[model samples]
Target: MIRSPRGVEDILPSQVSQYQWIEKEASSLFSLYGYEEVRTPIFERAELFLRSLGEETDAGKQMYIFQDKKGRRLALRPEATAPVVRAYLQHNLYGKTREWRVYYLGSMFRYERPQAGRYREFRQIGIEAIGEGSPYLDVEIIEMAHQFFKRVGLDKVELQLNSIGCRKCRPFYEEKLKEYLKKNMDRLCPTCQRRYQYNVLRVLDCKNENCQLVIREAPWIGEYLCEDCSSHFQSVKEGLKALGIKFQINPHLVRGLDYYTRTIFEIISPVLGAQNAICSGGRYDDLIEELGGPSVPAMGFAMGVERVLLALREEKKGIPYKRLPLIYIATLGREGWRAGYELANLLRLKEIRVQLNTSKRKLSSQLSFAAKRGIRWVMILGEEEVKKRRVILRDMNSGTQKELEWEKLEENIEEIKS
Candidate 1:
């Protein structure tokens, strides 16, 4: 049989509850902050990413691009912010309200060299607040992310913060960076050398060890930020400080995307080693206008769902393993099978979880199957018991058994559940 494609894997039944719990936590927390949920198409017109991520950036290049029968280019969305902005503009949301707050949870596709916590098909939990430009909004977005990690019992992460300045000052810093990178051109990685010429700021986001060393001595954007951008950065810092959230300033932390401005940050889990940024986002003040909407200033962030899950596992601080309350109904004969069916339905109608055995196996074999499945309760019905309208209820955990009247068991559903 054919296997799952490389760089992609299934979220099997054993792992679904954890995803569901994370989903519920995210939905509740975002709603508490006045953010509503929005879902866009998985694939969008290919041009959207080119405009948002810039044609030379890694995200734009990694797009899984294809064409419809009519030859219109489309691609799976590599991130949610671009499509969310598209939705905002397409719906003319800016005209209706000055600010639109929305959150999204979904899969994104990127053709990448897959590794731990990174996949070709991945999921992200993100929020976009469009039309507000205050530095305080930046603080709130960052704080919300911090609170989310804490809420999920992940305390082993650190927040690394920075300001890449806006369009006004970024050029000055980029020029200085290019000048410095040229001095170390021979030492820099081949990819960084190319990036230095084409998309200069992305060179800072390079993961190559040699590149990182070169970047350490390069010009820091903070020293070159224009007065306006500097003030904005200060205000963001003050707001975060006032809220008692701790952060470390990372001078070389320019995010990989092209559209970020003024402020950017990443939440890193040391447990994940070098590729440890579990969450990242920042302000994109001009992206909406860049994509054909009114000049709107928005800020948002995205948490890599798989990365966060990995961090949780490494630290052993995730949702506890839980088996849903289940009573396995094992049948011994045809009549027992028919009665088991009725009992399962009645119990289900009472909002109880149940699994009725289909295997026509012996009683001992059935009990062994239930034990291996970790099902605590088992209702065994055989020919003799079915005739008397009574069934044996066995507690698999304690290896205890008792006979329960069929009608009594149905009336007192709590007994089976307890």
Candidate 2:
């Protein structure tokens, strides 16, 4: 038998209810923030990720790259923000509104070692607010994310916040950080040593124990932020405080993206050990212009649906599944099967959840199958019932039965279930 590729999971029927619940709750919550949904392709030109995520980032390194028949390079999207920005420019959405608010839910592909909440193929629910630069908007987005976690039944989630500084002062901070790293070069990890030459700030995000030790005393970006960035950061904190959204300022909290600027944050849950971040994003004030669009400030975040589900499981939270069929039609001969099929469609037209048994099984076997599946109501259609133009509806829960005329079945559907 052929097997699925490693690190990808099949969302089987037994487990799909949880994902459905998450999607529904996400749509509802996003709508409350005036964020309409947008969808982009699953793949795009490889240059998009390389340019947006940067050459040294893990997404650019781990993306699934391939060539089409025409030899054009393309990659399965490893994240959604770049694609969303591309769509915004391609459609000239910025022309309509000063701030375009949109959300997306889809699968993202990456090549990585599979672990507890991480997968090679994963799902992300994200929202983007483009064309706005106000610190109030920043606080609003953070509060919206917090509200989403609450609606999803998550608790003990820490909002780790930071300001990576913008281009104005980041150059100075980089020089200082490079100097620090150089003085402690021997204590740095080999990866940090290599990254120091290309992306020095990444060393602060390094997970290596020794590199972390070296990073502890490194100059903080907050100290070097220009006057504009400093004021904006302070205003964002004040706004968060006004809204009662608790956050911790982590100087080392540089998110894993090249586009982020000014403000960055990660929502970490203790339920996911080691890989604790369930959602992360930040302000990318220059990304829109970098992508060839007009200068537009944008900020958005993506939540790992798999990690959220894992957190929910660890919390033992109960997510209600979609309602099951209220009635099942079990037919006995060819004539009964024909009548049952017709009745099933009629009931369905009236918005009733009915399951029609299509098997050529005996009446007793059909009823047994329905019972085993926990179906509450079973409508029996046999030769006698077909001739009489009526159905015998049995209540599985109460072991009660009632006969109803064909013409009255639609009108009595509610009463029959009760």
Candidate 3:
């Protein structure tokens, strides 16, 4: 038997209900926050990521890249924000309104060692607000994630936040951070040493045991934030507090992407242990301009749907799928087939889920299948029932049977529901 590709998963039928439940909840919440849906292709030019996500980050390093039939370098999207930003500018989303709110649900591909809640190909539900840079919007996005987890019954989430400053003050912080790392270079890891020169801010995010200790006491980004960035960061905290959402300020919480300027955050849960972040995003004021589009300030975050599902499982939460509907039609002979089809259609037109027996099994076997499938109302249409202009509605659970007039079938299904 051929196996699925490594790090990919088949979301089997049994697990689909959970996914649907999450999608429904996400749709409702996003609508409440005034975010419209936007979609982009699964693959784009490889350089789009290199230019937008940064050539230095691991996304550019470990993405699944190949030459399309036309020989243009292409890659499965490793993240959603970059593509959404592209569409925002291409379609002039920010022209009419000062800010445009959008959300997307899609798959992202990355070449990484799979573990609990992390996969090579994963689904993400993300939201982006692009146009003017407003800290109120920043808080609203953060609160949106918080509210999402609460609605989904997640109890182990932590909100870690930071400000990476902007063009003016970030350079000063980077220089200072680089100087601090240079002094401690002898104790730093090789990766930290290399990153120190190119992107010193990333050094703070190093997870190596020794490298973490080396820069444990480095200068905090919040202290170095310029006046405007400082005030904006403060407003985010105040706004979140006003909305009764709690957060923690972590000085080392800088984003790996080059485009993010301020207000980076992660909603982490301890259930996944060390790799704990389930949802993460922040402000990206320069990405639109950097990607060759007109300057537009944007902020958004992506939630790993697989990770959220795993968290749901770990927490032992239940996703409720509607019970299989009342009507299962079993036709005994060829003539009954036409009658069964007509009755099933009429019942469904009244908004009922009706399943017609496609098997040539005996009545006993047909009823057994209906019972096993949790089909409560089994409608039997033998030759006599069709001739009599009636259908036998059998209640599988109670082992009761009744004959309903053909025109009263819709009324009978409604009574069952009631």
Can you give the TM-score per candidate against the true fold?
0.95, 0.93, 0.92
Model 2 lDDT per residue over 1-418, tens place: 9999999999986578788889889989999999999999999999998999998887779999999999999999999999999999989988887578999999999999998889999999999999899899889999999999999889879999999999889999999999888899999998889888878888999999988888889999999999999999999999999999999999999887889999899999987899999999899999999999999999999999999998888888887784578789999889999999999999889788889999999888998988988888999999999999989989888888999899987667878555
How does model 3 score by TM-score? 0.92
lDDT of 2: 0.91
In candidate 3, the residue pairs with backbone N, CA or C atoms under 3 Å apart (3 or more residues apart, or in different chains) clash, namely none
> What's the CA error at residue 411 for candidate 2, in Å?
8.1
| Model 3 Cα lDDT, one tens digit per residue, 1-418 | 9999999999876677678888889979999999989889999889999898777776777799999788999999999888988887778766767577889998999999998778899999999888868898898899999999999999788999999999999999888888788889999888888877666788899999998887689988888999999999999999999998888988888777778888999999878877778999999999888888787888999998988988877878776665466678998988898999998888778778889998788989999998998888899999999999998989887898999898776677668776
- TM-score quality measure for candidate 1: 0.95
C-alpha lDDT score of every prediction, in listed order: 0.90, 0.91, 0.87
Better model by lDDT: candidate 2 vs candidate 3: 2
Across 346-369, the per-residue lDDT of candidate 1 in tens digits comes to 888988888999998898998898
Question: In every candidate, how many clashes are there?
Answer: 0, 0, 0
RMSD of each: 1.9, 2.2, 2.3
Count residue pairs with overlapping backbones in model 3.
0
User: Considering only N, C-alpha and C atoms within 3 Å, which residue pairs clash in candidate 1?
Assistant: none
The alpha-carbon deviation from the true structure for residue 171 of candidate 1, after best TM-score superposition, in angstroms, is: 1.3
